[model samples]
Target: MNLLDYVLPCLWAFLACVGFGLVFNIQGVGVLICGLGAGLGWLVYLVCVNFLTGDIFSAFVAAMAIGVYSEIMARIRRCPVTGYLQVALLPLVPGAGIYYTMRYCVEGETQLFLSTLLHTFGFAAALSIGAMLTSSVLRALLPKLRLGRE
Candidate 1:
């Protein structure tokens, strides 16, 4: 909604991408491109989900867009989509929910903890399913885009 919210998410996305790139040893301009791509992907996802339609359909569309972008980048860079997708998707993870759930559990709030944990798990499952579906669709559509074994 506000500029701070947008800026923070993009900043996190950039940092996640940079961390992933470092772990995978992706160097030079490719790392910069991946970081930028991750930030843009998160921005696009947030825009679509919040502005267009805050519904399951919008979420799936955003996830698919992320997957496609990551896959395309992986193909170009000759690396696995895991590197790009994981970093690009960090913003979508239910981190706050998970943290709250764990915090409640630690504070002896069993009922609230269970409820929050379930919600977090559900959110995580949705994200996983979306990513898996997107990956499958991409693989089916672009059979020639091999990764990592070039």
Candidate 2:
């Protein structure tokens, strides 16, 4: 991919993070925090896709990492995880995949439509599962960290 591809994705992720922060009523610096989280997550996704030769799996892992990191940061800062996780997860939403699937369906291409729909749903499911699993692990580990007192 070219610079435009990288920059556009990061820009979209940042915008999504800003919207999420606004909707959630996050406090000062939360918007920046969320945007940075999203940018970092997208960077990881881009690096994995470009260098690791992995496909959606790399994206899934990147999303999970973002969720975990966001949770840790939220705990440290005593803020809501929603702001960070929602922004970080913007890159993994499969927006284009779902849009193409819906477009194919509208064109009456049944097989192609179904295939794309399945791919989109599978990608989305993987993202949700990965995020949930990471959150669970973080929850389990947080109690042992003794960071809550800070």
Candidate 3:
């Protein structure tokens, strides 16, 4: 509800992305870029969730932010977008949902497991759709944008 609520999560997301960057051998400024992208996504997610109805929608919006951010950063640095996008999105992945769903399944809680698994799938779908939509739109538009600038 307050600043700390948003800041803490964004900070954690940034750190997590930085760790993923390291694991993926992303070095130098790339790591920082990935961390910033994660923080940016989490910040968007927090703001949207506060104002929007569903967390799923929030995740979608956040993924769009990360997608746009990664695309721009890649262009600026003249590098592949894959590493930045993947590392940045690490924080937003539904790891906890998968874990809990599996735990519930193992415990024979069919109802909870089913619900959680469905919700997790929905969230994942939203994330992928958001990122893909952004990337596709940008790919279509960037050429026009460059021509205009020239």
Top candidate on lDDT is 3
Find the number of clashing residue pairs for candidate 3: 0
Global Cα lDDT for candidate 1: 0.74
Best candidate according to TM-score: 3
Ranked by lDDT, top first: 3, 2, 1
Error of 2 at 144 (Å): 1.6
lDDT of all predictions:
0.74, 0.80, 0.91
Clashes per prediction?
Answer: 0, 0, 0
User: In candidate 2, where is summed lDDT lowest over 10 consecutive residues?
Assistant: 141-150
Output the lDDT of residue 146, model 3.
89
Total clashes in model 1, counting residue pairs 3 or more apart in sequence or in different chains? 0
TM-scores, in order shown?
A: 0.75, 0.85, 0.95
If both were scored by TM-score, which would come out higher, candidate 1 or candidate 2?
2
What is candidate 2's local distance difference test score? 0.80
Candidate 3 TM-score, C-alpha based? 0.95
Tell me the lDDT of candidate 3: 0.91
Pairing residues by index, what is the TM-score of model 2?
A: 0.85
